[model samples]
Target: MARPSSDRLGYLLVAPTVLILLSITAFPLAYNLWNSLRHVVLTDPSSAGFAGLENYRALLGDPQFAQVLARTSLFTVVSVSVQMAVGLMVALVLHRRFRGRGLVRAAVLIPWAVPTVVAAISWKTMLDPQSGVLSFLFGVDTAWLAGEWTAWIAIAVADGWKTVPFVAIILLAGLQVIPGDIYEAARVDGSGAWHAFWKLTLPLLKPALMVALIFRTLSALLIFDVIFILTGGGPGDTTETLSYVTWREFLVESDFGGGGAVSVLMLVLSLVIAGAYTRLFRLDRREG
Candidate 1:
């Protein structure tokens, strides 16, 4: 055989990585898509057959799914917004030159470093109605996770507590890359801190914000671990997210086809949110 060019050699070198990705990710995705078009109720093995678009159509027509999607959207929106706002504050504080800043930064990361399930379980224990810390301290014995709305709040609080530090870390990275000279110039021009942040910091931090938003939004939309540990979509499906619903279908109900359809829908929702953020921020364009 003739000697391969550098380009060809590069492709050959990358081929293994590409193949590995296809095997792990693409293969499962393809299989899920295939399954979504069929009947896959585990209780009815003999019922498996091609039923093009039936799963999708039935899912769309499901009022319960509609409720689940809306709740998921609400959770994602509220959690991401809260995380970003809190993260921005923490990032600003971390960016400041102060004593013990290093320790503070590391300490902030503890929650993020902890495993999600562990953190959720810890929160669940702490929020227990009868004898939990909150109940003991407040002296009212309010059941934090008993009611529908309260359970959602408890889940959001737990998720936010665990993930806010991560958002802070990302935002801090973005904040550091910004040139100090720009802020100095703004100050010299009589721009107040609030004004400068609104005009300069936000615009400059657009790239990082977009990245954090996409990550957190996707995480929020697909939120399951916290819900699983804290609420279990219980109290009559009040906290039922789409990801939880998918899990219920596949494992609890043993309807692989329906679960596959929901998985596809989740993927589409993620793509749509990512695309919206990219377009909203004009992320691809070079700012002159």
Candidate 2:
């Protein structure tokens, strides 16, 4: 029949993309699972044999893994929270039409347009202890990456600067989609701007805010390039995140088995967080 032939043609048309996704994503994940169960190391690739769950057990027992997990959680929590706050403020300001609004919007996106490596290098230069702009401007020579707190601050600054604009853009789109009549109605009901914002705007913007938070949280959890280029997980590994630890295991220490285990753990953590967000968003959407 024509319908059967059409379905077959459609399947053939989409087959290549599905095959590519499976090859690139599914295959690597499967390979990593197999690799994690082995004892492969840089110096003993030939002697590598199945080690079962030993790598995962060792990873769980390692205290450094615990510290990295803690640091990663703090980083993701603090950075995502700050980025959302700043982004919401920016979005609220841009929601209203004003003179040079388009120019302002474009300017805000400039930070987001810059590459992560470039932003990291720039922030590192700006925050350097000696001959840095902050020290020169403030007349205080403080090492931004020398102390754990300072290093975290520097990393947060760079990340928030780069990502806040993305959150703002998403929220701005949501704000624009909101009907103007709602605000007019609130005004007619003698509601102050603050009341209307907190009562109406915030509730309406919940879906967009959740989406932005999930995106920013995931990205913040996987933060590496900025910290790597800026602090190198220095100050006695105080700034070492899970991604950094994973990178060090595979690339620096050349322990494929341990690295694969870390990768699996990272994947699981991300999935858990994403799943929570997905469930919350679905519930919100149903209510809305």
Candidate 3:
């Protein structure tokens, strides 16, 4: 009887907080779903009606949306891959005992600490063809953000510069928790640095790698600020992502139903990607 009473009291204590959280998150989601199922163009109020799945069907049938989806996926893959590679290298370097190691660590975090908009703007300025430092150094007059591939390269570099430190920090934490004795034993067994890293370090770093990969992948998939500030999805909408499309629908086109549908789709995509990453990591752990 006492145990049951105590459990009830505990539940009562947390009930308010749980309810608040649900109200904040669940209510908005429910509203968005409702909005998605109706035609709600702000400019054309008389045309509003029940849309059912019409918005989704229209989005799916559009060739531009298909291109945007593919572009977003490719950008996510490229940005996450580059960030992981560079971050791992930085983590390995930071793990070593060196002069001014603390300073180097702090310096490495400066890029990540900067605001995303500021970072994007800085990159935009640096890539300016007429007066940019990069153009002067490379002795080329190419407009970095004017071309399709070059613009992507610029965005990738900017995003990587801002995010690689976060991945490195996560990896560095994982590295620190690893037992040094294992490395000593490997060295005694005549295993070289590369062999030890491949056979021992990587296996132990899986959890941190998974965390970093999931975070960076999701951020890349929903990327908006950098593209908004730098390219504005210009040079013929080549860099526009799903998030941008959603924004265009809601804010630009005044199509609330279309925007709501895009938002719901984005939510679904995020959930699916997160679940996939969690499952993949679990599988890797089981295999290991």
Candidate 4:
């Protein structure tokens, strides 16, 4: 038998990995899409049948779903904006040549390194009405998780604390790769620090910013864990996000069809947002 060529061998090597991906990701996605198009209520298996676009129509007509979408959008915007701003500041500081810089960077990563569940639980404890440190500091016994607005704030704080470090590290890497000679050249041209940051640093940092934005936006849009653990979508469903609602449909209500519909919609929204960011970044690059 003739030996396989390099190109054929490369495909052969990757074939198994591709097969694994198809088995896990592609199979589940296809199954979900099928489920989304049919009624699949575990509680009423006898009535399960082709739903067509019924579930999608129902969800779109639901005021609660509209609220969930609005809330999720707000959360994504707020969380991502705050994370980017704080992350950029942290990255800038870390990019400086200060003593104990490495130690500081490692310390800054502690929040990101901590597991999400642990961070969420810790935040819950800290925001407890009676004995929480935050309540004591504010000099009020307000129940942070009992109020709708306060609950949102607490969730944002917890999410931002855990994720800001990751954004900072990514931005810091971007900053490191930026040739220092650019700054030197700016200095030679009598450019101020603020001017260079606006004109040079931000323009060059667009790629990294785009990356962090997409990741944070998607995570925020699908936020569940912190809300689940912290508030259980409490304060009268005020914190119930799209993911939480989907989970409720699948597990609580045993409505797989509805859950799959929500999941499909979420996937579409994520793709749209990601594509928008990518397109915007490419346009900015071209214009620059």
Can you give the TM-score per candidate against the true fold?
0.95, 0.97, 0.95, 0.96
lDDT string for model 2 (1-288, tens) is 699999999999999999999999999999999999999898767978999999999999999889889889988998898899999999999988899999999999999999999999999899987988999999999887999888888889999999999999999998988899999999999999999999999999887998899899998999999999998999988988889988999998899999999999999999999999999889977886
Clashes of each: 0, 0, 0, 0
What tens-digit string does per-residue lDDT give for candidate 4 at 1-288? Answer: 455687799999999999999999999999999999999999899989999999999999999999999999999998889989999999999999999999999999999999899999999889888999988898989988999998999999999999999999999999989999999999999999999999999988988888988899889899999999999999999999999999999999999999999999999999999899899988988887
Between candidates 2 and 4, the one scoring higher on TM-score is 2
Measured by TM-score, how close is model 2 to the native structure?
0.97
For all candidates in order, the CA lDDT equals 0.92, 0.92, 0.94, 0.94
Task: Highest TM-score: give the candidate number.
Answer: 2
Instruction: Flag the better candidate by TM-score, 1 or 2.
Output: 2
Give the RMSD in angstroms, all C-alphas superposed, for model 2: 1.1
Candidate 1 CA-lDDT value? 0.92
For every candidate structure, what is the RMSD over all alpha carbons to the true structure, in angstroms?
A: 1.7, 1.1, 1.6, 1.5
Instruction: Return the clash pairs for model 4, or none.
Output: none
Candidate 2 wrongly placed segments (more than 4 Å) = none
lDDT of 4 at 33: 93
Name the regions of candidate 3 deviating beyond 4 angstroms: 1-5
Give the worst 10-residue stretch by lDDT in candidate 1. Answer: 279-288
Scanning candidate 3 in windows of ten residues, the lowest lDDT window is 279-288
